[model samples]
Target: MGLRRKLLVSIGLILAILLVLLYLATSVILMSSFSNLEEQLVLQDVNRALRVLETEVLELNRLLRDWAAWDETYAFIETGHPSYVAQNLDDAVFANLRLNLMIFVRYPDQILYSKAFDPQGNRPAEIPRGLYAYLTPESALFNLPHPDSSVAGILPLPEGPLLVAAQPVLTSRYQGPVHGALIFGRFLSAAELARLSQMIHLNIDVRAYDDPSLPSDFQEVRSSLTREKPLVVQTPGANSVAGYALIADLLGRPALITRVVATRDIYYAGQAAQNYIFLSLLAIGLVFGEATLILMDRLVISRLSNLSTSVTRIRTSGDLTERMAESGKDE
Candidate 1:
């Protein structure tokens, strides 16, 4: 190939290789950095949502302590007072407290009173039939040996998931010959979840792990939730990323899955920055390469060609008078 064409091709090839290497390196380092940042932010948002739910459970337990230790509640559990239910278990109280079910039962099994309320409908509802299974002696609710020790945790029943607390009925002053346990339950219904999502200002989704039907994303996340990785992060699409965590029940079984999705603004911004820089460098390289080729042609290549032509003519025609063109500029 001619020198000019060869030079152009060589420079182009070199520039392309350099650009490719830069792109790969930038993607590996820059993209990885952005991905780690996005995962941390997503995890923080979702974990905050989870913390809000946990705080609700803790607050509900505190509320239970208030009622369970009251003088009226101490008498009502033993007497089976119709007056207590009439005076205390109003529909508004259930709706205000967001309570779905409450039961008064003695240790090892006697269920004295049970009430379930539909908060939305403002009416009495049938209690979860599986409620008793969680109240058995095997469970933490009725197995309390100390008045100071109370129970509060999640119960994933057939009807739905419940945030329940069981406290031993005692005097208002905290004195207890420990009568029966007062168990309170609230279903983690859609409305309740919505309220929690709004409170935390984060989009959160919860799915039952053992449910017969779960969303495709939930199933994928569930598989990733190994003992080593309780929290898994993923990019479901080009524009969005998500964080997933398992919610274990009181028995430490995988009961629910919580997911938090976020927009890929950080990643997209990094990619845009990379592209802009690569394009800018490409433009600069092209301009610089053109200038370099022109300089070489003028200062060295053109003069060398002229000198060769003059020498060839001198040798062929026996004319020793011809001279090569020379320039003052440095090659």
Candidate 2:
């Protein structure tokens, strides 16, 4: 091949290899990094949702403790005091407490009082039959022996899931010989879920662990909930990710699943950024390759071509005295 053609081929080959390497590195490393960052962000949002849910449970337990450890409540459980219910369990009381159901169970599983209320309307309602039936001698609330002990959990009632708290009835001082247990429940209604979602800035869903209607991806994530860390999974063909955490009942069985979903805006943004970077690199490579080829033509290939022309002229005209031109520049 002629000198200029050979130099062009050599430069083209090197630039092609470099460009391929650049593309591979960006695709493999940078893309993977962006994916991991997106996953981490989703995980962070899920963790925030988990923390908010935990705080709600804790608040319920604290409210239960306040009501259960009161002197009037202790007396009402034993004497069936009509004045106590008329005074304490009234509409204002339920509204202030934000409780849907209140149950006072005497020792050995006797339900002294059970009432359900609508906190929004501050009106009485029928307690969920499933919840009423679930409170038996074997229930965790009735089995508590210590006045200081309390149980808080999610329970799937016929109406819906409830965040329930139970505490052994005692004096306001948390003092002993517990007569029974006082239970409070807050329904996990649509309003409540919306409030929680707003608080955490993510879409949240609470479902029974064995709920058959859960999406397949959610079920797959839930299956991995045995792990200590929350399970995070990308929803198929969606621009969002989901995270799952198991909420156990008072008896320590997985009762509810908390799912948090967040969009992958950051991932898409990262991909855009990577594309920009790749384009910038490609442009730079093109400029660099062009400059390299121009310099080789001016400093090396041109001189070699001149030498070849001189040799050909000498061979054809039989004049060995012909000399080639030389530039002042060093090779």
Candidate 3:
């Protein structure tokens, strides 16, 4: 082959090797690093969502404390009178607070008064039957020793998961004879979840952890999560990534699953960067290869071609007088 063709082939082979290395470095190292960073950020978002839920529970507990320490509530638990319910425990209170339940119970499983409301319907509703299971004599909701005792956390029920709190009934001054326990509950309904999502600016989904009919995605994540590995992050689609976590109930069992879905902005940005780098390298290689061809032609190939043509002419004519010219270059 001619020198120019040979030079092009050599340069092409070398550049191809370099490009392969570049592809591997970008795909394996650069993108991997960006993927890891995206996962970490998603995990952080999930944690922030969890903290928001915890704040909701804490707020519910504060509301419970306000009622539990009221003198009217302290007397109503003993007297079982309708006057307190008439004056304070109206439908408007539940609607305003968005509360689903209020229960007054004496120690050892004696329920004095209870009411459950449906905020969406703007009416009173029956309390979930499963709630009584937690109110058993051996239950922790009412099993308190001191007047300052209070408890709150998630409560998973067939209707839905609830944010529940309980406190011992006390005088308005926070003084206590510890008569009984006052309980309050609010379901984490769709409206509530949407409000929470707005508050945190993230898409949140919740599933019952122990339910057999959970969606495949939730089941997949649930099976992967353990006490040791409490969180799972995954990419379900090209445009979005999801983070999963387990929420334990007041009984310390995994009762609910929470998933946060976010856009793949970080990963997408990395992909764009990779494309830019590859294209930039390709352009540089082309420029370098062209420059190399020009230098070869100027410094070596053109002079060699001229010498060969002179030698051929002298051989054909049988003339020894002709000379082969050389350039000033070392070649």
Candidate 4:
């Protein structure tokens, strides 16, 4: 090949290899950046969910405290007036108290008098024993033991998965002596949990269990209930970043909240950025390759071609001085 052709071919090959390396490097960088961004977004989402949960727990606590301090509850329980208790368990009180259920677990006696209400203020029959026992005095109202006691933690039921909270019902007759205990609770409904999940844009399954034998709501996923970090599920492929987030809820029940994202979407986003970078590098390489071709054609190839012509002219005419006209100008 002629000198210009040879130089051009060498430059193109080297530039092509460099461009390929650059493309790979760009892809790696883009992948790292996109993965970091995705992780940040997911973390932010998880934080937002935690904040919402905190607020909900605070609000519910406030309402529960207010109900516990009510004088009507004290009088009803203290006087042992089931009739009066029934009357005060009105829809109006339930609405005003912002509680779905009113349960008075008579401590020491182990008798539970509870009333159920809908949002509109209509009182319903007490929930059946199987469901209500663990939630009330009958089951020891497990969570409300004295703060210093070992039994202060809430305990779950055997047959049905339930965590019971027992709060001591103090009597004013002896200037706030612990007369007995009271159980107040509302089941963590699937609908309520689903609402919480939607607020965080997560698909969550919540399970509460006191008994080891009972089937768990967490689909039998053997996980430490105490771990604070999220359990991660990873996606396949080097370019993909799909995963699942497992979050634990410890308030009403020990539950797991899971969030999932697809790897295909992550791969597409990263690939899109990488493709742009490759195109830009390709353009730069093309420009450099073309410029090198032009320089060699002008400075080196033209001179070599003129030298060849001049040698031929000198050889044919047997003249020492002979010149060849230079031809092209690169624009």
Measured by TM-score, the strongest candidate is: 3
Per-residue alpha-carbon lDDT of candidate 3 for residues 1-331, written as tens digits (9 for 90 to 100): 9888998899899998998898788778889999999999999999998999999999999998889999999898778888999999899999998899999897656988899999999998998998888987678787865787889999999989999998899989988778789889999999999999999999988889998999878878888987788899988888999999999999889999999999999999999998898998899988998898899888778878888898899999998987777568574
The segments of candidate 2 whose C-alpha lies over 4 angstroms from its true place after superposition are 120-122, 227-230, 329-331
Candidate 2 residue-wise lDDT, 217-294, digit = tens: 667777778647445556555677676777776666777777777777777877887888788878988899899988
**Which scores higher on lDDT, 1 or 4?**
1
Which regions of candidate 1 fall more than 4 Å away from where they truly are? 321-325, 329-331
The RMSD of every model to the true structure, in order and in angstroms, is: 2.1, 2.1, 1.6, 5.8
Return the lDDT, model 3, position 278.
Answer: 90
lDDT of 3: 0.90
How does each model score on lDDT? 0.84, 0.80, 0.90, 0.54
List residue ranges in candidate 3 displaced over 4 A. Answer: 317-322, 329-331
lDDT of 1 by residue, 1-331 (tens): 9988888899889988887888788878888897788888998987887798799889989999999999999898778889999999988899999899898886556888889999977899998987777778767888775789787878788888889998899989988888788989988888888888888777787778887788777877787796577888888888889888888887788888888888999889888888887888788888888898899898878888887888888899886786666667564
Ranking by lDDT: 3, 1, 2, 4
TM-score of each: 0.92, 0.91, 0.95, 0.71
> How far off is residue 23 in model 4, in Å?
1.4
Instruction: Please give the distance, in angstroms, between residue 166's alpha carbon in candidate 1 and its true position after superposition.
Output: 1.1
- Pitting candidate 2 against candidate 3, the one with the higher lDDT is 3
